[model samples]
Target chain A: MRASAESNGGGADDDAAQVMGDGRHARHVTLKDVAELAGVSVSTVSLVMNEKKNARIAVKTQERVNRAIRELHYRPNALAQNLVTGTSKFIGLLTDSIATTPFAGQIIHGAQDRAWKQGYVLLIVNTEGNEDIERQAIRMFLEYKVHGILYSTWYHHEITLPQSLKDMNTVLVNCYSDTENLISVVPDEFNGGRTAAKMLLEQGHRRVAFINTTVESPARTGRLAGYRRALAEQGIAEDPSLIVDAEPTQEGGRAVAEVIRASGATGVCCHNDRVAMGLYDALRNRGIMVPSDISVVGFDDQEVIAAHMLPPLSTVALPHYELGASGVDAVLAPPVHLDDHRVLIACPAVHRESISALD
Target chain B: MRASAESNGGGADDDAAQVMGDGRHARHVTLKDVAELAGVSVSTVSLVMNEKKNARIAVKTQERVNRAIRELHYRPNALAQNLVTGTSKFIGLLTDSIATTPFAGQIIHGAQDRAWKQGYVLLIVNTEGNEDIERQAIRMFLEYKVHGILYSTWYHHEITLPQSLKDMNTVLVNCYSDTENLISVVPDEFNGGRTAAKMLLEQGHRRVAFINTTVESPARTGRLAGYRRALAEQGIAEDPSLIVDAEPTQEGGRAVAEVIRASGATGVCCHNDRVAMGLYDALRNRGIMVPSDISVVGFDDQEVIAAHMLPPLSTVALPHYELGASGVDAVLAPPVHLDDHRVLIACPAVHRESISALD
Candidate 1:
C-alpha cells in the first residue's frame, strides 16, 4: 500500500527515522518505519493500526507487524486528528447503573470496541438510579465537551431528560423516550417474546403459560403483547388464566408456579431467566419433571442461570454487547428523522434442554 | 430537631447558608430553616444530607424537611469545598466495561451514592475492555485534572496502570497491580470461599467436592485456599479425589459432574455460581436429586443463578457495592503507606435451600 502512494517524506523507507532538531531525545517512530520493518505495505500498517477487518493479510504477517510496532514504540497520531476536528475524540456514556449487571458490561464492551476501531473513546458516568443524578451527569458530559452522548437505562423507565440536551447529539439505549424523535437502541423484547412463543408452539404445545411480573413495567407489557401476538398468529385464543404475575424475584417465580399449575399449562414462558430459576424450584417442589410434565422457556439468557438450571434453560437471548455498541453508534451517526429513530437489535432464541417436543 | 437547630444557626450553619450568596441567588434557605419547618435541628438536616447512620429522626420529620428544601428550591453549595482545595469536585471512575455485567453497576451505585453525599460527582470513562483505551482514558482524566482516580477492572487481571498517575491518588477495584504501595479494594474471594465451605460443613456434610476452573486464576486460588482452610479447621482431610477442574462453562460442569459421581462426594463447592449452574445441569442429566443425593454451593451469588437454580443456590456473596464505595473513599482520602496498603472487605454467605445435612 505504501509503495503505491506518493511520499510525504523523503523517498527513502527510513523517512520516519529523523531525530528532532531540539535534541531533547530521540524522535518518535511513526507508521512508516513499522511498515518498512515488517516488510508490508503502508496501507497494511494502517489496517493493522486501525484494527480494520477484511484485511487479506496472513495472521503470521499481522502478528509480525504488531510485534514490530510494539518493539519500536510506534504511536499512531490519533491526537492530530482530534486537533483537526476540534473534537475530544471522546463519547459520553451515561448509564443508570454501571457495575451490577452483565448486560450493561456487554453493551459497553461492544460500544467500546467499535469506538476504539473508529478512533473514539467513551466517557462513562453512572447516575445511581436517580433522575437528578442522570441530569447532573449529562451536564458534566457537556462541560467536558464530549462529541456525543449515549444514555443507557437500567430498565425500561420513563426518563425525564434535561432540556439543555434537547439540541445535543444523543441516543438512548435499552430505553424509549416520549419525545418520539430521539434515537433509541434497545433489545427487541417483543420479537424475543414472539420467538420464544413460536418455539414452544412449534413443539406442539397449545396450553402455554406466560409467567411475568407487574404489567406496570414496560418490558413485561411488551413481552405480554408479543406472547399474545404469537398466539394469535397460531390461531390460538389467549388464555387469561395462564397469565401469572410474579414479583421479579426467586420467591415470586416459585409462587407463580401454583398459578401455572392451576391453569393446566404444559409450557411456561418466563419473563426472565431469574423468574425461570424460581419456577424450577416450584416445579421440583411439586415433583414435576421439566420437558416431560412442563417445558420451561426463559428470557435474557443470563449466563449464570441458563448454564446452571437443572435442565439448562432454553431462553431468548438479548444481545447486550450489540445493544451497547449500537447505542453508541446511533449517537455517533443517528438516523435523520424521528420515524427512523428506533434501532431494533435481534434477540435470538437460545435452544437449550429446558423445552422439548410435547407428547 | 429542626426547631432547636434553627434557633442555633450559629457558626457552621451560618457559614454554609452564606456560601450560597456567592451569586445573585438569595441566601438560600438554610438547612436550619428546613430543620425549623420540620421541627428538627440543623445537625439532623446535615445527617440526612450525608446519609449518616444512627439517626433517630422520624420518617415524617425527614419527609417534612425534604419537602421544605424542595419548596424553597434550595441547591446545596456543598461542592464549593472541593473548589477551594483545587480538587475537581468530580472523581474519575475508570472501568474496563460499563454495560456488560451487573457487578460494575452495583459498585458504581454504591460509590455514586457515597460520593454525592460527600458532595463529589463522578466523571466516568469506559475503556471498553481495551488496554490501549484504558491508557487513553487515564490520560484524559489527568488532562481534566480529576481529584482522584478509581480504576475498576471488568474481570480479574493484573493491571498495568498509567505511568503518569504514579503521583496521583489512585484506587483499583476488583483488580490489583504488581507494583507496590497502590491501594486496591477487591472482593474477598478467600473469605467467600471460607463462608461457603463453612456453611456446607455446618450442614453436616463430610464428603465435599470442589469444582474450579484454572488454578492460575487468583479468584479460584483464593477460593481453593479458603475451602481447604475451612476443611482443615473442621479436622476434615482435603481429598484430592474430590477436586475437579471444570471449565467456567455449563458444559464444563456437566463433564465435572461425571467425575464428581465417581468420587462419591455428597457435597460440592463450585468456583462460581456460573460453574455451579453447569453442575446443576450435569446432576439433572444423571437423574441425581440435589440435597437428597448431593448438596451444592456456589460463589459470586450471581442474582439470576442464585435465585433460579432448582433448590435456590446457596452461594458466597461478593461485596461488589462495598468495594466500589470503598475504592472511591480510598482515592478521596490521604494515601495509605504502600507497606500497609491492604483493604479487605468481608464476604458473607447467603443460605438457600440447596444444601441439606448428610446424617
Candidate 2:
C-alpha cells in the first residue's frame, strides 16, 4: 500500500509537470495568478472557479479562467480560509441516524442540497441514538469549529445539551430541549391531525376515531390536538371514547381497529402511517371494507403504506425534506433576540383514495 | 460572535484555575503533567482519557488515573496528535444520499455502532447522486486527512473514483468499483436470491416466477443467479419464461402481475418490497387470494411494505446494518498483506406470511 501511495503521489506531480505552461514555480498558485494568466479580474477568476461566473462574465472569458485554473493546478485553501475567516464553511449535522430511517436521510438531502448551493459542506455524524456518544461527537464538532450545529433526532423527545455545546448556535430537528435558547424545527403534527380529520369529515363521515400510540409521544399529542381542532372547526363534538391509544406497530393498529369497530365508528384517523397499516389488517380480518364499510386516513404519508395499501391510503404528509432544510436554516439564522424559541414547519395534507364520501 | 470568540480562549485558562492543587501555577496541565500527577505512564493516561484503559490496567489503577486526568482537565490535543501521528481518528463515510432512504440509515447505524465501540468517529458526507459532487466530497475527505473512507452508493452501480483517492484505503459499501485492489463489503445479493428461492421450494412450490426491474441491474443478476442455482440443486429445470422484468415500484408490480397471471404462474418473487406492494394492489383488484391463488415474495424487507401488505410480505432481507458495520471493520482492519483486496458479506433471509405451500 505504501509503495503504490508514493508512486501515485509522484505520478500526480508528473502529470502536473506535463500540464505546466511555464517553468515558473510559485509554490502554490493563487486566484490572482490564475486571473493574470487568463487576462481576467481576480474576482472573475474566483467566480469562475466557484461556478458562479455565469451572467457575470462572457462565456469565452469564463472558459479562459477555467483553462488557467486547470493549467496552474490551482486548488483553493479551504482550511486556511476557514481559519482566517473564523467560519469553517462546514455545518455539523448531528443526526441520531442519518442512514437508518428514510426520514433522516430525506432531511439530510434537503439540508445538504441547500447547503451545497450556498457553497457549504456538511460534517455529518451519526450518533446511533447513544447520548454519551452524541456528547462526544458534539465535542469533536466544537473542536473542529464548525459554523453551526443541526441536531436531528430519530424520534421526538427532549434533548440534553452537551456542556461544550451550550454556547454554540444549534437547531434541533424533530426534537425539543428544555433549554430556553435553542431553536427547534418540527413537522406540523397539529395541522397534520387537523387535515386528516377534515379530509375524512369532508367525505361526510361522522363519528371518526383517532387511533394513536401514547399521549406521551409529542407527535401523537400534536396530531391529537389537530384532530380536536379540526372537529371543533367543523362544529362536531369531540368524543373521548372515539380516541384510543395503542402501540405504534402493526399489532397496535390491529388491536385499535377492533376497538374502533366495537365503538361503531365509521371513520378512523391514525396518529401516523404505521398505525394505519395495522388498521388495514384488522379491518380485512373483520370483513370490513376500507372506504366502503369505513373510511381511513393516516399521517406521515410513509411511502410504503400510502402507495401499497389495498386502497392507496389517504394521509397527511410531513415535509421531512423541508423540515431538514428549514432546520439548517434555523441553525444558520442569526441568534434569537428573545428567549422564546419555536419554529413550526407546515405539514400539508395528501389525498389518495382511502376515504370515501358517506352517503 | 466576535465578542464570544475573544472570550473563548480565556475561559479555558480560567477553567484550568480550579486545577491549581500543587500551587505551582498548575504548570499548564499537559498530558505529561497528568502522567506525573497520576504516577502512571503517559500511554496509560491516553488509554484512560480515551476510555480504552479498561482492559489495559487494573480497575483500581484505572480509576486513580481517570480521577487525576479529570482533576487536571487535560484535554487531549486531537489535532496536534493527528498531525504528529498522521492518523486522524476520523473515518470518512461517503454516501450517494444523506437522508432519503432507510437502508442507508441502517447501514450508518451499524457503522457508527462499531466506530463508537472502537473510539473512532465518522465524518459523513452525502453525494446527492451526482458524480461531480462525489468527486468533490472524496477530495475533501483526502484534504481532511481522514484515516479511511467508506463509499456507499444509493443504488448498485459501478463507480469511477477520483485520482486523488487511488491510493486511499477505502471500503465500498452497497456498491463496488472495477478497480482490482480496492476492498469492498457489499450485501450478498446472490445469497439473498438463493434464500428466497429455497424458501419457496421448501414450501412445496414446484414453479415460481422471478419479477425484477431490469436484466442489467447487478442486484437482479445476483438474485437470478441464486434463483437458478437453487432450482438446479432441487433438480428443477430453469424456465426462461419465469423471469419477468418490471419496474421496481408499486405500479410496476401490478403490471408484472398481469403478465404473471397470463403465464399461469402460481408463485412469484419480486425484485423488492416496493414491487411486491404493487402486486398486492393488482391481486386485490383481480380478487386473487395471496398465498392461496398465488404465493408472493419480495426483497429488501422495507418495514412499511412488510408490515402493511394485506398479508405481511415475506422478503429476502438486506443486512443493511451489517453492511455498515462490516464496512467499518474493513476500514479499521490492519492492512491485509499489500496484495489482497475485496471483502463480501452475506445477506440473511427473513420469512413472513407472504409465501405459502402449493400443496
Candidate 3:
C-alpha cells in the first residue's frame, strides 16, 4: 500500500514460502498471488481490499478479485497499510499496577472493549511504579507510533505527568495530573461518600458515624464532607464526635468498634469493605449483631469481600470501568478543553442486606 | 541492520521534524544527523550502534559517535531497525481472560519481567474469550512480524489450539493442547494437591478429611489422588467416608462443613481459600473453632482471602508466575523437543496460622 511495487517482483502465483524477519517460515499469500490469480494488477487488488470509493473498477473484475481472495485467503498486510494510511490503529495504555490489583481488571476490560469497538487495539504496559520501566515503555510506544496513550493508575490519585508524555495524546484514567496539561477521568469521590452516608440515613438512622481512613486522600476528605451534607439535609446537626479516623482495614474497623459503640450511633459508614468486614468480626466477638444492633454501610464494593460477607455489605462502586471507557473517549475525541480538565464518573451505590430500616 | 541505503537520501544535520504514519509530528534525530555530528559516515555510526565486531572503526571515532549520540539524545528507531534486522524485539502474548482474573496478575508480571530482561517487549492482547478478536489479533501479530507468541489462559486447563497459530512459534502458559503440537508450561496439579494434604499430615492429623469441589477438573482429580497418596505413604488406609465433594466456592466450603465435622476428622484440607473462608464461618456458626478444634488447610494461597481469614489459611501456591516465565523461556529457546512436550512447574506449600501441631 505504501508504494511497495518492489515487493511484487516475485512472480505471481509463486506460492513461495516467505522467511519472516523473526526467522519464522510462513506461506504468505501476497497481493501479487491474488492479482495474478484474478488476472489483474496489484494496485487493483489493494484498492479492492481497502475498498477505495474513488478508484473506478469494473464490477466483473472486482468479483474476480474477491473470489481469488477467498480462495487464497489473503489478509491485507496491516503494517504496510499503516505506512500509507498514517495511522497505526493502536492506543498505548500505561498503568501503575492495574494488573496486580484485583478490582482494577474492569479498567482494562472497559478500555479494551471501547478500543475494539473503535477499530483500535490497546498495547498495555504495567509499570508497577518503576520509573525506568515507564520511561522505556514510553520510548517503545513512540517507536510503535501509537495513535494515543491512556495513562492509568490502580487507584484514584494525583500524579506528576512524565515529561516525555507531554508531546503525546495522553489521557489519565482513575488518576489526575496537578498541571492540567492533559485531560483526565476520575471517580466522583464526594458523591460516592454522600451515597454511602445516604444509604444509612434513608433507613431512618438519625445518628450516623463516619469512620474515615487515617490516610490522607481525596476519599478521606470528600466522603466526610458528603456524609456531613447528607446529615444536614435530614435536619441533623453535624456532630464532630461522630467522625472517627482509623486505618482503612479490617483491623482498623475492629479497633474503632468500641469507640462507635460508646458514641450511641445507630448506623455507621465504613471507609471500605475491608473495614466493614473487620467491624463484623469485632461486633460478633462483642455479641452485637449487625443491622439489629448497628446498621452498617461500606465504600468500594470489592466483590470478594462485600458480596461474601455474613450479610452482603451495602457499598459504593468505584466506577473503574466507566473511568477507563471515558479516558479512551477523551483521548480519541477531538482535542477540546473540558470543564475543569477532568471528567468525574459517578460512583454508584450498591444496596445489600447490611442496612436495615430502623423501627 | 539490513541495507537501509534508501533512507539516507535526506541531508545530514537537518533538524527537520518527521511526521509519523500516525500523524504525530516528532523531532526524530536520525543516524545521518549523528554521523554528521561525529564527522563519520552513517554506516560507521550504525556499526557503532549495533556493535558490529567485524567493522573495525577507530576507537577515537567510536567515542565521537557515542558523544554525538549522548548530546543529541538520539534513540535508534526500533521500527526501522526491525525492518532491517528482520527481527522485531516484540513477543506477542495472547490471553483468554488474564486481565479480569484476580490471581492471574502474576502471570503477566512474570512474563513481562522475563521479556524485559531478555531485551524484548511484550505486546499483549486480552481476547476475553472472543474468537473473532483472537483471529484478528493473530493477523495483527503476523503483520507486525512478532518474534514469537505466548498463548496463555487465566487458569490451568486444556484448550484447542487456534488453527492460525500452527505455523507460528507459540508456547502455552497455564494451559495445554490436547494435540501436543506446541510446547506448554503448566502447574504440577498433582504436587500442589499433595502439598496441601501433607500440611495437615505433618501436623500429626491421621484422620484428615478432604473437602473437594464437585466440579470435575484436573485440580479435583489430582488433589484427591494426592490426598490418598499422602495417607498411603503414612501407612493409613484411605477412608472413603472422609472425602466430601461440593462447589469450589465459600458456599461450597459451608455446605461440606457438616460432613467434615460428622466424620470426626481433626484436620481438613479444602479445595481453595474461598472454601476455607466459608468453612471458617460455618465452623464458628456451629461453635467449632479452627486449629483448636479442627485444623484446616486450603489450596490457592489467594492473599486477600487466605491472609485475611480470622486465622490465616495454610495452603499451596499455584505457581502462576513460574508458569508465565517458563512460557517465555520456551518460546525464546532454540527449537528442540521437550520432554513429553510440557514443562510442569512446582507448586510450593505456604504455611500459615490455620494449622496446629497435635499435643
Candidate 4:
C-alpha cells in the first residue's frame, strides 16, 4: 500500500466531489449530461450507447445523441453497461508466474488476442504464488463480475483450486484441477517427448538417451512415458539405464553427458531447450561432435536457445501460446457437455539442424 | 471475431433475456426488482446503492434497501459507478512485446504489483509492434477511461506517439518520447554498460574487449560508450579493434573467437548474458579458460543464461521490473513539473564467478 501512497489523492468520500469539482471544466462529463445536451431521456441515451435499437428510437434522435457524446467526450461507463446487459467485457487472467517466466509473454499475448477479438479486455492479476493473493484476486474478479477467470500457472503443474473459483466459470491453463469436470488447456508433454524421441530414432539413432529433470514434474514423467512408448514401437527393448535424471537446466544437461557417453547412446532427447544447451556444451567440451558423432533433440523449442544453437536445436515446441488462446476460446465459447473439458494442444516437432540422417 | 464467435451469444439484446430466460429464474434481478422487494422508490434504491445517505434518507429505509440488495444478490453496475466516480480502478498497459520477450514478464509483474496494491487492475494490450493495433489499443484505453496508460516496448527504442494517446495520461516504460515533457521510466542502459565495464576494470584487466550487437541498439551503443570510457579512464588507449560487433546472441559471441584470440584482451565486457554464453563456448572450444586467462562481464544478467553458465556469469542487471512498477507509481502520483518527467532507475552490478582479480 505504501507503494501507491503517493497516488492516493482522496479516498472514497472525495470521489463524488472530485467528479463535480473540476474548476476548469466545471463538472465531469456523464451520460446524464449527454442526455441533457441531446434533449433525450436517460434511457434513450443508454439505448443509443448500447446499440440496442430494438425499441427503435428515431434515427435523428440517435444521431443527436451520438453528436452530443462526441462533443462532450462523454464516454459511457462500461461498468454500468454490464449491469443492465449482464455482460462484463472483462476476462480475469489470474496467474501465479505469468509475469516471471520467459514463456509468459507468449501465453498472455495469445489470451489477449483472443479476448480483444471478442470485444473483451483482459484483467491481469499476478499472484506470485501466494495463496492469500490468489484468494483475494478471485474475490476481486468476482466483485468486478468478470466473464470468467483464466487460472494460469507459469509452468505445467497441479494446483489447489481456490474456493472462490468454484462459484465462477474458471478455465485452467498450463495446469489442471484436482478433480475432473473443470475445463483445462495444457500442452501434450507426452506427445512432445514421443516426438523428440521419434525424431532421433528416424535419424537412425537406435541407442537414444533421454536426460530429464531431477525434480518430479509432470513434464518429466509424461515425457519419459512417451520416450518409452516411442522406443517400444520401434521394437527396441526398454533400457531404463538410457534414461537419466538431472536438474532440467544447462548444468543438469552437462552433468548427464558422462552417463550418456558411458551408455554408448548415439543420440539424446533433452527435457527442454536449456538442458539441451548444456548438453551441447558438455559434448563440445568432450570433443563429441553433433549430428555426425551424436545427434541431439530437445523439448520446448525456445527460440532464443534453440535458434541460437550452433546448428540450431531440433526440438518439440511447447505450444504455450496456443494453450492460452485455446483456453480462452474454450471458456468463452458456448458451454459444451464433455466428460471433462480437458483439451490438450500438441507440442509439434520443430525440426531444425541438430539431427542428421545416418547412411 | 472468429476467435470469440462461440462466446458471442446474441450480443447485447440476449443479455437481459438470458438472465430472465434461465427458466429456473422467472425474472432477472434489477433495480426495479430490488425497489419492489424493499417497498421503496427506484430513486431511493439508487441513492442507497450509491451510499448518498445525504441525511434525508431515513436510517430504517437505508437498512431495508441494504437487506433487499443482499436478498436479491444485486450487484451494482461498476461502469455506472465509475462514470459517477470518475475513477475506473483500472490501468491500461499498452505494450509492444510484453507477451513476446523473455524479460517482458518481469515488467508486467512490477506494473501489476504496483497497480493492485492501490486497488487497480491492469488491462493488458499487447500491440506486438503493430501501429494499427497500438492505435486501436490506445482508443480502447481512452474509451475505458483507464486511470493511466503504461506504454511499454519489448526492447529499448524510440516510438512515434499514437494520435489516440494525445489527450491521455500515459507513462512510458523502458523507453522515452522524442521530445521532453512526457513522463518516462526507463532503465539507465548507459549506467548498466558502465557497470559492466567497471566490474571488469576493477578486476585489474587493462586490455578489455566489448562484444556488442552488429545491429544498432541503444544497449549496444550505450554499452560500447561505457566500455571505451572505462578503458580511457585507466589511460589504456581506446583500441577500435578491441570493440567487436556480433549479432548480440550466443552464435555471434561464438563467432568472435579469432578476434578475441588475436586482440590479446585479458578481460571482456559482453553486451548481454546471451553474448556471454556464446563467448564461454568460443573460449572453451579453444581451451582458453575464463577468469584464469580472461575475465568476462556482461549486461542484462538473464537468470537462465547467467546462472547456468559453467562458472556462472557476472553481469549488470537490467532492472525491468523496477521500470514497470515505478512507471505506474510515477503516473498515478500527483504530477510534478520538470523539463521532461523522466525517472531513471539504476542498473546495479551483480557479481558472479566469470570475473576474477589478477594476481
Candidate 5:
C-alpha cells in the first residue's frame, strides 16, 4: 500500500536498515555485556537482576553485578523475562475511537492511575474503529502475554465482540456484548437522566421539559425512562407535549427552542451539554434569560462547555473516569461469572449557576 | 503505598495468584503443543511459524504444522520472536497530560494511523505529568526494547528532559528541549499567529486588535511578533492601545470587553477559541453583533467549540495532528544532526462565518 502523505519517510527497504540501524539506536547494553564486566556468567547476572531469593550467588558477586549494571546502564529485557515467567505486568487497552473523543482523557487518566498503583502499566492502542487494526492489536496483546485486555468504546452501546476475543480474559468498558459473554462496565445512564430532571424539579419547576435525543441508543432510551421515573416520584403526570425530540447537538437545541418556549415549561432538561449550549444561543437570540426566564439543566457535564458556559450549566457527569478505573479493577481481580458481570457506575449531578429556585 | 479508592481489589498476594492464575487467563497453547499435534518436533514448528527461507522441512510437514496452528488457534509469540531477532516492531509514546487535553485526540489519532501503516504498533502511556511515573514508563519502554520513543506534551512549550530519556531514541513532540539535545517537532507559533492576522487583514480590516495571552511563553512572544509582521507588511503602524493581554480564557476575554469596544478597532484577533467564545458573550450582552459591527478571528480551531459556536469561529488550526505524525517520522527516519533538527509544522487558517469584510 502507498504510504500516506504525512508519513513522508522513505520506502520499506530504507526503513529495513534503520528499523534496527546504527543512526537511531545505539547498540543496546545487554546482559552479556554486564556479565563480562562483572566477571560473572550470564545466568548469574540474570539471577542478580531478577533478585532471585535464595540463589546461591555470593553477596560480593551480586554487588559486582549490580555495580556493572549501573556503570553500563543495562536494562533487563522484559520480553525474555516474560518468556520464562509466563506472565507480564502489562494490561492491554484496545479502544474504538475513545482517543478521538474530547473527554476520553478522563477515562485514560483514571485507568492509568489505578493501573500504576497496582504495579502494572497500561499499554493503550486506539483502534480508531478499524476492525482490522482491532484484530491485529488483540493478537499483539496476546503475543506479549498481557495480564488481561480491556475492550472499550467511545460511548455506551451494544457491541459485537470480535471472534478473536473469545478465549482471552477480556472486560468491556462503556460498551457491552449481547451474548453475555464478557464482563462489562458502563455508565448508569438511567440515573444520570434522572439526576438532570431531579436537579430541575428540586428548584420547584413542576412543568419540566426534556429535550431528548432523536438518536436511538441506550442513553436515549434509558435516560428517558429515568426522566419519567423522576416525574412519577414527584406525583406529576408525564406530559407528552413537553417531551420533544432533537438531534442531540447544538443545532438540535436551537431547532427546538420555539417548541420548548411554546410548551410553557419553566425549566428544561437537555439531552447533553452541547444541546444545552445551542439552547443558550437560541434563548439569547430570542431575548429570554436563563434561570429568571427559564431554568436549564444539561447532561454529560463536559468540562470545556459545561463549566465555561455563560451561566456555567448545571448537569450530570458521565462517570467515564469510573468506567475506566472499574474496567481495570475487573480485569485484575477474580473473574466474575459471565451471567453476573455487568457493572454500572453511577453518574453524579454537578450544580452550577444555570439553575435557580422558583418562588 | 496504599491503593486508592478506585482500585477496590485484593492485595498484591491475591493478585499474584490471579496474575498468572486459573480464574482469568487460560494456559497458553505453546509451540510444543502445536508440534505435538502436528506429529513433528518443536524446531520444525518454529521454522514454519517464522517462514524461515531455505529450511529443509518437507512440504507435507509444513502443511501439517500450519494446520495444527489453525486448529489450536495458536498465536506466534512476538516477544519470543523478538528475543531471537533482536529487533521489535513497537514504538513507545510517553505523554505529559496529552490524553487529558480536549484536542489531544487528534495528536494520538495521527500518530497511531501513521505508526500502523509502517507495520509498527504504538504503546501509549499518558504520564499525567508525574515525574516518577514518567521515569518508570521510560524505564519500562527501554526494557521492552521499543524501536523508538516519542516524548510528547499536550501543548507547545519548552520542557526539561527526564534523565531516563537521555539514552533512548527519543523525539520531542509539540515541545522542544532548551539544550537542543534532541530532535523536535512543534507547531509554527509565529506563522500560526501570522496566519490569524493575515486572515483578518485580507478581509479589508486595517485596524485589528490582537488579544494575546498574558502567560510568558513562546506562543506569547512568537504570535505577537507575527502579528506585528502582518501589520508591517500591510504598511499599517502597530497601535499600542489596540494590543491587550488577557488570561487566555473565557473570563479573561469577558474582562476586556469594554476595552476592546473602546479601542475603536474594526476587527479583533483572540488568543484562542475559548477567549473568542467569551468575547462573543460579552459583545452580545452589549448589543454588538459579530462581523456586522466588528469582525473577529480566533486561534486553535478547537472543533467542539469553534464549529459549534453561534457563528462558527474563523481561526487558525494548531497542527496538533501533524506534530504527532511528524514526531513518529522523526524517530523512524535517520536521525538528523541535533543542532539542525527542529521541525516546525505550519498552522493553516480556517474560514468560517465569524470573519467578514470590514467595508
Candidate 6:
C-alpha cells in the first residue's frame, strides 16, 4: 500500500465548513454530519452507506438514516472512498489513435463491453502518440486510482514502454515490448498470413503468388512466414519466383500485375484487402476476369474495402475485437506469470466472393 | 450550483479515520497532517495548496509549507477541492460510438485537444445507443461534477434528446433537435452538394446530373438542395430528367451507370464517393473513361475510396473535425443565448483527378 505516517495538529474538525466556504462546488454531505443528524456514530453512518448488513442497526434507525441521506442528497465520492479501500471500480484505457481511427474503435468498444460487464467503468485517454502527453495522462490515471490500465496502439508495432508505467498493472494491446516484462495482447498477423495462404491453397491453387508489402514491416515478416508454413504443410516447395513485392496499396498491386500475369499463377495472395482490390483493378484493365482467369485472396478483412469490392474479397480478419476483449480479460485476471503473460488470438478466414477453386 | 443542505451526525470529523479502518486503501495525506508538519494552521495549508498568496502567510512560512507538502506527498483530492470551487477541470464526453466509429474519434481528439489546452481532462462514456445506458451514464457524469457534456451520435440524425440532459451544459454534435432547444453543430451538407455541382459547372459543364440517396436522409435533402441552388445561380434550367436515385453504396452507383450515361450529362454528381467509385467501376466495365468520355464527381471524400480511386475521386469532405472541435468550443463557451445556438460548418471540396474541364 502506498501510505504514510498519520500526523495532525488538534483543531476543530471544520474541514467541510472550510471547503464549503470556498463555494465552488455543491455542498457535499459528509458522514460526520449524517451521524449527528441520525443520532448515530460515524461508523454507523459509514456502514449504512456501504450497505453492510452486519451492523444490525434497527430497521427504524435505517429508515431514519435513509431519509436523512435522501434529504441531503449525499452522493458518495468514489475517489474519496478509493483512498481508504485502495480499490477503484475504474479502468483507464490509453490509446494512440483508437479515437481517430475508424477501424480501431472496435478495440475500445470490445474493451468497454467487457469492463462494463464486470462492474467497472472505462475512462479513455487518447494520448495521440505524444510521449509527454502519455506521461501526463498516466499521472492523471494514477491520481484517479484506476484498478488497471490497458495501453494500446493503432497498429501492430513494437513500442518503448513509458517509464512511468513501470509499476502499474497494465496490458499492452496491438503492440509489444522487447523486454517481455509486460503482459502483451496483439493480433496474430502471422496466423492471418497463413490463413490467407490456406484459403487460396484450399481452393486448389498450387501456383499462388504472394504480393508482399514493404519489407520492413513486422506484419510482412509474420504474414509471409505464415504463408510459407501453410504451403509447406501441403507438401509444396517454396517457389522463390512466386513471391513478389509490391507497396501495400491498390496502385502497388496494380503496378505489379505484369509479374502476377507472367508467373502463370492461377491465384494470388495480397498483403491486405487494399492490395487485393488494386490487383483486381489491374487485372480488369488487362482484360482478365477474377475467378474465371485467376483467383485472389487478401488479408485484413476491412469492411469498407473487403465487403464492397466488386467480387467481395476473400480475406483474413485482424481479430481486432478479440484482441481488445482479451487484453481487458488478461489485465483483470492477471495470470500467474504476471509480467510474462502473452496471449495470441487466432485470425480466422472470411470467405466472400474473391476466391475460386481451380481444380 | 446544484447543492443541498448539510445534514449529519458529527463527532470529531472521524470520517477519514473511520474510512481508514476499512483496512483496504493506502492512508491519504490530509491538510491537518500538513499543517502539523509545517507548524502552521490547516487554513494556511489549504491556501498554500490553492496558491492563494493573498492568504497573508509569510513567504518564508509558505515555502516551509510547500516543502512540507512535497515531503508529505499531500496531493489534494480534486474531487473534494471541487466542492468549494464548483469548477471541475473535467469534461464529460458521451457518445454512441466515439470509441467504436473510426471517424468519430476525431471529434474526441479535437475536443480533447481543446480541453487539455484549457487544463481540463476529458472522461468519455460510450452508451452503445441504449436509452437506459445513456441515462445511467448521465447520472454518473453528474456525480463526477463534470464542467460540461458533449452528446454525439454515430451518424447525423434527429434524436429524442434525453430528458436527463436538459439541465447540464451540453452541445450536440453531428445531429439536431426538432425543438431547436440545444446548441447543435451539424454538417452543411446542402452547401457540400452545391460545391460538388459548382465544381463541375465551373469547368464548363452545362448538362450536370445529380445522383442522390434515399430522399429521407437529411444529407440527401441538404446536398440536393445545394445542387439545385448552384444550377439556379448559373441560370441553367434544372433538368428533372437528370436527377436520379440510388442506394448510398458502390452497387447502387454501378446499377445506375446506364442512367448516368443515357442522361448524356457530360458531368455527373453521385451522392457520395462510394457511389462515385461504383459508377467508375460500371463505366470502366463499359470502357467509358472518366473525365474523357465523361466527367464524375462525388461527396463525403472517404479516404479509403476517394484517395485510392483510379482517378482519385473529386468529392466534398464531411467537416467531422470541425464539427467535433466546434462542439467543444460551444459547450465551453455556453453561448449568450444558451438555447438556440446553432453553428453550421462547411463541407469543402477536395479536387482530385476525377473531375475534368471541358473543351
Specify the highest-DockQ model's number. 4
Each model's TM-score? 0.66, 0.75, 0.82, 0.90, 0.88, 0.84
Tens digits of per-residue lDDT for model 1, A1-359 = 12222222332312111211112112234456678778898668767766767777788889989998877665455332332222345677777764456555666667776776666667666665677777777666554446677878766555766675555567788777876466788777778789889889989999999987764666787788889999999999997888888887667788788888888988999888878877886777677888788999988877555756677889998788788788767665655444556788888989989888975
Q: What digit string (tens of lDDT, one per residue) describes model 2 on residues B49-90?
A: 666534567788787887776876644555434433334567
Q: What i-RMS does each candidate reach, in Å? A: 14.1, 9.4, 6.3, 4.3, 3.4, 7.0
- lDDT per residue, candidate 3, A175-204, as tens digits? 888785677888888888889889988989
Better of 1 and 3 by DockQ: 3
Output the better candidate (3/4) by DockQ. Answer: 4
Tens-digit per-residue lDDT, B140-192, candidate 1: 55544465778787656577777755545677777888774577787777777
Q: For residues A1-359, write the lDDT of model 4, one tens digit per residue.
A: 12121233345426423422322112235566678779999779988988975979999999999998888777656666666644577788998887788865678879899998878888888898888888878777766767777899988888888876764667899998767457788888888889999998887778899888877767978989999999999999988889888988898898888888889888889988899888888888898888777889988888577888776899999998898898788667634565456688899999899998876
Residue ranges of candidate 6 with Cα displaced over 4 Å: A1-76, A337-340, B1-77, B83-87, B337-340
For each predicted model, how many residue pairs clash, with residues at least 3 apart or on different chains?
35, 9, 2, 4, 0, 22
Where does candidate 2 clash, by residue pair? A99-B104, A99-B105, A99-B106, A100-B105, A100-B106, A105-B99, A105-B100, A106-B99, A106-B100
Q: Candidate 6's residue-wise lDDT over B1-359, tens digit each?
A: 00100111123324323322322222345566568778998768778888875678899999999988887666656554554432456678888876666556677778777777666777777888887878877877766657768888867778888887765667888888877467788888888889999999999999999999974767878888999999999999998999999998888999999999989899999998889888988899999998888889988777556888887888888877787778877766644543345688899999889878886
- Candidate 5's C-alpha runs over 4 A off are A1-25, A31-72, A334-340, B1-25, B31-72, B334-340
Clash list (residue pairs), candidate 3: A21-B86, A86-B21
Error of 4 at A296 (Å): 1.1
**Tens digit of lDDT per residue, candidate 5, span B1-359?**
01111122324234434543544346555666678779999778989988887897899999999998987777778777666544467789898988778787678878887887787778778877888888888878877878788989987888999976775688899888877468888888889899899999999999999999998877899999999999999999999999999988888889898899999988999999989999999999899988788888998888678888888899998888888888888878845554456888898999999888865
Model 2 C-alpha lDDT per residue in residues A1-359, reported as the tens digit of each score: 22222322332234223222122211234455667779988667756766652447788998898887777666654543443232456778888765567655678777887777666677677776777877878777655556678888766667776666665666788888876457778776778788889998887888999987774767878888988998898899988999999887667888777789988888999877778877886787677888888888887777545756667888888787887788777655533443446677787888888898987
Question: What lDDT tens digits, residue by residue, belong to model 6 across residues A186-259?
Answer: 87778888888999899889998999887466688988999899999999999888899998888898889989
